[model samples]
Target: MTAPAVTVRTGMLDCIQANLALLADRWGEPLRHLALGAHLRFRPRPGPDGLPTVDPPPQTHIRQARALIGLVPRHVHHDLEPEALRALSRRTPVVYAVGDTHDMPWLPYAGRARMEHSFLVSGEAGEACVEDAYDNETAWGPARPGRWRLPWEQLPTARTAVEFTAPAAYRAPRPAVALDDPGPYVQAYAAHPDRLTALRRLTSETWLMARARHLHAAYREHRGESPDTHEHLRRWDRLTATAFIALRRAERGRPVPDSLLPDLAAALHADREVFAVRDEQTEPPDPT
Candidate 1:
């Protein structure tokens, strides 16, 4: 039998988003298991000379998913490589990791591929997955069914290896968006650390209706006029709810997963259950 090619090489461009843009986009495609979607990207930007610059872009590929799902971190954290494998199982039957190995060469994992039908992660980053079964890969290796790690020098004399910074879009909040330092608006708008205060305030039951009334009444009492009845209490409610949620989450920790944050944000949309009031139960907390 003929042996498979031991090495593979492609332009930095194709390798850039190919894993995520092409492979991870849909069925028959590979999926990304990133936890905290940082600035790490393969997309290039305009360079100083106005030419297409494929050089390294400013980015941070966070090894873990994130400290919080919605202003709070999960109780337990995960390593890098494993998270991606687990996330891919949701849509496709298999998962493949191309880069980011600590001490070795490029590594690809197929044994841990997940079938979307049976995926069931309780409360971990989608990227927060099973650690690679093999050692950390360094470069590229022969293409195979499972992880393939290689070194830059291992490439055939004819093959060459180049390096560049990949571009990316920000999905999860990073250190820059710290929660403790931001003000009320940020606390309300973001899910960063500043958001911890916001989430906590929201789930803690601040009674924004009364606060609004108080603010309005104060305005009325002072101006001898009606309250601000614009019904634009969303911002205020969001702040309260977010803070409360943050506090509760900080105390107990753990939310669904990073992938689910987008869906959760869509559902909240400043709804009463999510923002204005707790969606749990009006009857009261069940005391066991």
Candidate 2:
């Protein structure tokens, strides 16, 4: 007999959001947005021609995922393996970050030979099941059996692996839509001496300036070119730029220069607005 599949939600960011929501009737902590741009990591550097350019390092998504996970609950563990899988509760799902897979339909990165994906896992009657938003419609392997079965050989590269479990009596407060100021978020992250060192290295003056140029160039190349994919690329460029700026400011000290703050804020707002519009466009029309 086939094991029943667990609930799986998809959408790039919604995958994370839905999992967090599943963890509680409602989460206690607010999801912080230094800017949706910041979450996306939009860096506006100037090019040789003095135009804003955009380019993000390969690990941008992983880095952003790491930073954003701060908003969720504290229960987390690293590449601990089948032990982590065995420990998942039917009531709470465990989110796993792993290497790429050719099996998932929604991920363009699916065929890549590197670590860059995530999904949830649960168990029913001693049989483990994988629940993934991206693979919701794709039936293969364990998913064929109505339970999630991941490629066991690829597990080693997984990082930021976490399981969400709370005491029966524990309940969290509602999450905030946005933080009043992103300074505290930056400050807290930078306060960690080791992380601070890492951020400084990643946000060097020359690197950031070049990153800005790359981002703008990439955005221009893709803008308005393809209706289905153009906006996603645009969003990626914007997010990459935001990540660069946020890190650069954190490295320089929390307060961004006054002259630069308004522009950054505006860019951030623009990123959010575009995303809202794009999401609305893709959403299924209401029956009413």
Candidate 3:
């Protein structure tokens, strides 16, 4: 199948966004999937006839602020990184992050890592906690405290070591609304079909990848380690974005991107747990 053409032009990013329609329909899970970097990549490997090779890029894929913006063409420069996100919720003391595979309707966070108690961090008045459950995938949040922890190795023994990071323009946007709905603004502005569609897809993929990154960022914050742009976050979002664009292209009878095949196959399990990418690479969907 063909992938949608994702030309990154400055501003005027909204043209076609069926993904938004689908996401808005199934907002909650899809939103978390986006935060977790599910099917958001814009360039997938090519199919047998026309495929692109993808190797998940090198490890430590710190999302360059510029690259990530290119991937989704959104306006979330500051909220993409951990430190910047924490600042947004300075009053959201104790952000509960958790995940599972039951396809839970609400999940605070998503990833294949864990958070240790040592990493449980507290700001002047509030606390930011991340829960990355391995082999677990659920979509629900407002997590209960102590529901999860980071691995011991990733946590910092000293609270003083924790430091606020510069706001990054290369991370996922935090949950704009507690529930799936895009709140008042989304509902208000959705009538603009073309733009509405684009935002929906962008929202779904963005939300999922962020959910996953939150886990890792929390660990780094706990360990008092500085995050180096989260390279993995960019690659992750790229892969899913590719798949999403390709999926849309195919639905419209278009040509898939060169990387559609390889990247589609490489999608992380946590990313796929919620927004399952429907393509030839995945096992045949159960016909229940």
**What overall lDDT goes with each candidate model?**
0.27, 0.37, 0.30
Clashes of each: 50, 29, 67
Q: Report the poorest 10 consecutive residues by lDDT, candidate 3.
A: 9-18
- The candidate with the higher lDDT, 2 or 3, is 2
2 or 3, which is superior by TM-score? 2
Q: Would you list the rank order by lDDT, best first?
A: 2, 3, 1
Tens digits of per-residue lDDT for model 3 on 141-183? 3332122223322322221112222233334332211112123
lDDT of 1 by residue, 1-288 (tens): 122221111111122222222222222211222211212111223433222222322121111222211111112122323333343345443333333222222233223321111111111232222112221221234322123333222211111111112224423222111111113322233444444443433332233222422332332233333324334344444544554444555667655223223422332343222222123222311111
User: How many clashes show up in model 2?
Assistant: 29
TM-score of each model, in listed order: 0.18, 0.35, 0.23
Cα deviation at 286, candidate 2, in Å, is: 36
Error of 1 at 186 (Å): 2.1
Local error of candidate 1 at 241, Å?
Answer: 3.2
